[model samples]
Every structure is written in structure tokens, then in C-alpha cells.
Target: MKLKNNVLVTADWLKSHLNEPFVKVVDATYFMPGTPRDALSEWKGKRIPSAEFFDYDTRICDKPSSLPHMLPSADTFSKEVGLLGIRNEDTVIVYDTAGIFSSPRVWWMFKVMGHENVFVLDGGLPAWEHANGEIDTSEPTRVEPTNYQATFDQTRVIDKSQLLEGINNGTVNVIDVRPNERFLGLVPEPREGVRSGHMPNAVNLPFAQLLEAGKFKSAETLKMLIESALSDSKRNVASCGSGVTACILAIAAEYASGDVVTVYDGSWTEWGSDHELPIVSGK
Candidate 1:
């Protein structure tokens, strides 16, 4: 509760020091494939005061890959954030429109890029508005660019090759955070030409279970759920439909066990699409 590793920040704490120097609020909102809401449009209408938009779907991804929002190179990350005037010393609070949804992806992105001070705004924008927090309808303030630098931490990310090897050998806990239907191959995938099932040795632990009314459960609850699912496996690699929701598992794993954790950047988008990767249907 006392700002654990800068993983989360309360709305009250954020508002109290809202205008402090080196504090940067980021709106890291992104909807699913068929959602009616547009995150950028909503940001233009109402958002936390002085917050900047971090477009995870488009600008922050690997543009060359056909997969959705694959992690971009460290150089690209530096250039993209530098234009937003973010510096190494800044304390970043990232939030999403759907409370605890997509913001964790941004937090994971920052951490994998070697930014340790990044945190998620607990309960996101709704919590802010509920507390009578200020919302800026006008365009966010523009700032002079900073010379941002990123030191990529390979250990924080799980590449597809590593995942495949781990799955074959059963050395790592490959956890799929998709819904039960999708995990069991009872429903079709949203993307075309992709397989219906999950990785061979993967376990399904939907990200929704870790939340209650759009907020994370207590640390004790999270630790229990994660440990029960993982058994004795200490190393965890998370994946979901397109790598967005997988980060929720990554955050929960680290917050609970403080163990070695990584997220598969391409997730099922890459695995289910490739014909060579082994996948099985039903549980």
C-alpha cells in the first residue's frame, strides 16, 4: 500500500503532487479489436490534467511486424518518448480509460526499457473523476523534446524462440491470460488465419480474475492465486491474444512473487499464426 516499487499509485497521492516537477502523467489507453470507443478521441474530450497520450497500438510498436503492437526496439522507444519530453528522472504515472486494463502494458514497456520509476495510476481515469479531479478538455500541453535514452533489458521480455524452447523442456511457466473459451479453443480467434488453441504446456489464468471492479485485488490474494496456478515453477512467461493483456499477468506475477517474469511480445498473435509452432485444442 505504501507505493510498492512504484508499481501503482493512488489517485489521492497523484492529485496531491499533481503539478510537482518531473511528474509526467501518461494516458495509455487502447481498446480491443471491435470496441466502439476510441482512446485518442476520448483523450481529446476529457483527460487527467496535463496528461500526454502514449499510443500503444500504432507508434510504440514494431511497425514491420504484422502482429498487433509488438515491442519496438530500444532506439524507437527512445525517439518516441523523447518527442513527448519524457526524461530519465521523471516519475511517470500511466493510466487507461478502462481503469486497470491497458495501462499495465505501458508500465511493463517502460520497465523492459529500463525505466524503474514508472507506475500505474490505480483505478485509472474513472477513479480520478470520481474524486472530483481536474479534467482537461483542451489539447494537452506541448513541450520541448528531451534527449531520452533507453537501456533495453532482454531479461524482462520473452522472445518466441525462448518460449518455444521452454515449452518443450518444461523449464518455465508459460501462462496464457486469455478467456476460458479462447483458452479451450471453444471460440474462434479474432484474427484471421490464426489457430484456435493455445500453446501445448500453457496454463490459462484469465487476467480478469486478478481484478475486482477494475482494480487489482489485495497483494495477499494475488500471491495466492498466482502460486496456486504455477505450483513450484518460479520462472513465468505471460502471453495473451495480442500481447496487451499478457502484461497484466506479468505485473501480477512480479508483484506477488518478485520472481523472474517476462512477457511474450507477439503472444498468440505470432504463435497462433505461424504454421510451424505446436498448438493443441481443448484445455
Candidate 2:
């Protein structure tokens, strides 16, 4: 489960390595509610040659959860990924239609499942098309399922109870990657019924501040920016609307050489909606 030194790959690098036997490309596009786009249909229409569609919403989540797209059981994840023709040793490259959006979640998911060779496509599919890389509408090749089993990395993810305990004991810092307005409670949450503020004592990073047109800042720049917010404390739990954008912070933190980083799997959607949870406004 050891990861590469770098978790990002440029479009040029991926295009050149398309023919590598161990590579598996994944389209991990996901849109929030009220954003009108059918991810599955779009992938079926056109995608990077040899890329498979990872339906983050449907085929690979905790189906019984009232919350959106929570993590599935390790066995469930292993089986679904196995059905996608993924093997434990394969190198995974995940991208979303929106540059860098939602792709990091899949990358994080892979890492949590103990597959660390995965990388996010820098600037995502748009970067590939801009680079004039190959695009295909050909039917995806179906492959026989592989025997896949996942070893969950407990240190990479945190549940609601752990988050509450950490917050209460002041043993961990929480970072919310939501936009400034949402983090400050100036705007309503995109998900209806959810409150508009951040967790008590959580700091705001606004996920976008670490990117430029969907590409990440250099590791040095990222480290400096994060350090400016964190000062000296490094132990952190990341969260956002649902659980997706939280991983963006986790990935950025790792690239910045920060430690004690883990994602809150049920993020703001779960926290904000619970009236009993202590939430504060106006950072």
C-alpha cells in the first residue's frame, strides 16, 4: 500500500503511458445536486481511450445510507472495483470532467482501500483535451472480473464519533474546504436542510485557494499556504459538503508534506444537518 512520491500526473505523462499494461484510467466525474449533467451518459458518449467509468454515486457507495455517497464496506468496494476489471496491483489514474473537481475523492478512496499507486490527472480531462490527447467513443472493452480484496487504511479516514471526540478533546484540528461564503454561513448550503456554518474551531481553506484553473500549486507553494493557515499544528481532519471536496484538502496536504491528515467521511452534510451538533458562523 505504499504510495508514489508524487500523487499527480500531467496529461502529457498519462498520454505517453497509455499503452502501459499496468495502467487503468478512471473517469470519476460527479456533479452536486442542481447541477444538471448525467455523468454516466457523458462517459458512455466519450471518454479517454481505455478509461472506465467509476460511478461514484451508484455502483460504489454505501447504498443504504441516507447521506450521499458515503464509503462502502471494504468488501463491497473490492467487489465493485473487481467488477471494473481492476486488480490490486494496477496503477490507477482518475480524472473528472471538471478539472480537478471530485477526482481527488476517487484517488483518496483508492488510498483508503490500500491501493496507493493511484494518481489524480492534473487539471483533469480538460487538460487532456487541451493537450490534444486521444479521445474515444468506442465501446469499452469488457474484461473478466479479478479477485480483489481491500485492506482498509484506518488512519486515512475518520467517522462522526471520532470527529466529535477529537473536537471535544482538542486533540485534532479540523479543516473545512468549503468556499468562504459557505464556511462563513453567508450563503445557504447547496444541500437543502443542512445548516450553513462550519464546525466549532474548524479552520477554512476554501479548497480553490490551492489551485489555479484546476491545477494544483507547486508543493512548496502549497506547503507555504497551508502552513500560513496551520501555523505549527499538522494533525488535521478534512471536511466539505458531503465528503468529496474534503479529499482535495487531504491530497493537497500530502503534496505539501503535511502529516496526520485524514478525511471526515460524513462531512458537513452530516454535521450541519444534525441540530444537536455545535456549529458556529462567521469565521
Candidate 3:
């Protein structure tokens, strides 16, 4: 089923518009720390035509931060995205090799940077291959850099302090998108030095529940799943391992309920490592 929200575009739609001047395709794939597959290497081997790799981990992130892929400054984002030949008016389509994995994070990043025309390519590269979309293995042609402006939207993200205040004050519903095993401290975190268990009062949603066969479920299904976890009056905060998968929840929330989710950018990486913060395990 097609995504009800305008935030996503199907592979078929992208295949037809691949050569459009106003449409800019981006490969935003990312692999976890222990994964053997390298996203950049895989992209180099095979990717959609005219696609530029957006390196969220290294090139487009806050370099000084200890956290992984923390959001870069507005100026940095504008500069880096402009270097990719993306203009403010272009219809940006982002996708990952792992279907829906890191694409939403890139899409959310664009939104956070005040780019409204950005959309995630539903089902990603796999779907494109399925649709017989043209694949380009040759080196990406360098395009002239365009002027791009970015206005950072602080309301889209929440820091540790703001999250704590919201959780303590009961003003926000903290939705943890990690697997239940990780959420309940049943398994050790992949990252060292970080503790298991979830934030106090955070509910486990498990990002997979929002997807079916690596693609987002229908809007009705998403709405049912999201509404089950959130309260009507409280704001929503999406959190996950190192703040990446949290964007899936953020997109799901917006797609389902039209409620914008304020992502906890530091997420478990920051909260779990700090001994002072409270963590709860087991239902």
C-alpha cells in the first residue's frame, strides 16, 4: 500500500521522474557498528542513477560531539547539502539500501533543517531494483554547487535536559523505538559503556512494529499503533539507539496522527551512559 503522507514516494514514481531536473535523489544508507556490510562500499558498487551519497555519520554531522551523527549546525548543513547540488526548491528523495532504515532519519534531518520538499523513497534501493530502475556504477558526475539556505527548527528536536523536564513533568509521552529485548534490559546494548533498560516512564514501541516487510504499514495501521502508545494531551518524544531509528518513530507519528515528534537526539547513548539518569528494566 502507498504511504498516505506526502513524506514518502514509491519506487515506481521515482523511476519515472529519475531524470527530472527538480528531483534530486540521495542515498542515505547507514549500517550499525558491528554490521559487516559497509553502506558506502555497497553504494559504490550499485545505486540508483544520479544519486549522491549523504554521509550523515561523517560529512553532515556535528564533528565536535561525542555522540554518533548528531545534527550539524544550520550553516554546516546548508553548505554540505549545497555541495551535493541540492537547492531549496528541489524535490529531494532520500533512500537507504536497507529499505526504510536510515532514510527516514535523513528525511527528518531535512525537515529539521527547514527543507519541506524532502521525501523518503519508500522501500529504498531494494524497491528500486525490484521496479527495474536504472542502476549506475560509474562515478557520480560532479555538479555545480548551488546556493541553499537552512533555518534550523529547534522545536523538532529535544535535548537530554528538555526531555527530562517533559518526562518528569508528565508533559510528554516518551516512546522508545528499540526492540523489546533492549527496552527491558533483557539484552546488552551494542554500544559499550551504555547501560541497558529504557528511560523512566518511556513506553516501548519497537520500530519494527511500524513496518511490514521493511516498509511502512498503511496509515490506518500506523494510526492504530501510534495512538495506542500516546496520550492525547501530552507531546510526543521519539527515542532510540543513538537517535537514528528514532526518526522512524517520528515519521510514523506524523504520518499517523499529524503530531510532530520531538526527537531525543542523544537518546539511549547519552541517557544510558550517564549513571545519574534513571533507567528502568522489566515490565
Residue 70 error for model 3, in Å?
0.4
lDDT of candidate 3 over 161-275, digit per residue (tens): 8888887898988999999999999999989999999988889999999998878999889999988887779888899999899999888887777878888999999999999
Model 1, 1-283: lDDT tens digits are 1245637778898999789878888999999888889888899898998888999799988999888888899999999999888998898899998889999999999999998888888799988888788889986667788999999999889888988888888787888999989988999999998899989878999999998877888878998888866746546788898988888877877777775468898899899999999998996
Best by lDDT: 3
Candidate with the greatest TM-score versus the true structure: 3
Candidate 3, pairs of clashing residues: none
Instruction: List per-prediction Cα lDDT, in the order shown.
Output: 0.86, 0.88, 0.90
| TM-score list, all predictions | 0.95, 0.95, 0.96
What value of lDDT does candidate 3 attain over all alpha carbons? 0.90
After TM-score superposition, what is the CA distance of residue 98 in candidate 3 from its true location, in Å? 0.7
> What is the C-alpha lDDT profile of model 2 across 151-203, one tens digit per residue?
99999999988889888988778888999899999999888899999999899
TM-score of 1: 0.95
Better of 1 and 3 by lDDT: 3
Off by over 4 Å in 2: 1-4, 231-234, 258-260
State how far residue 231 of model 1 sits from its true place (Å).
Answer: 5.5
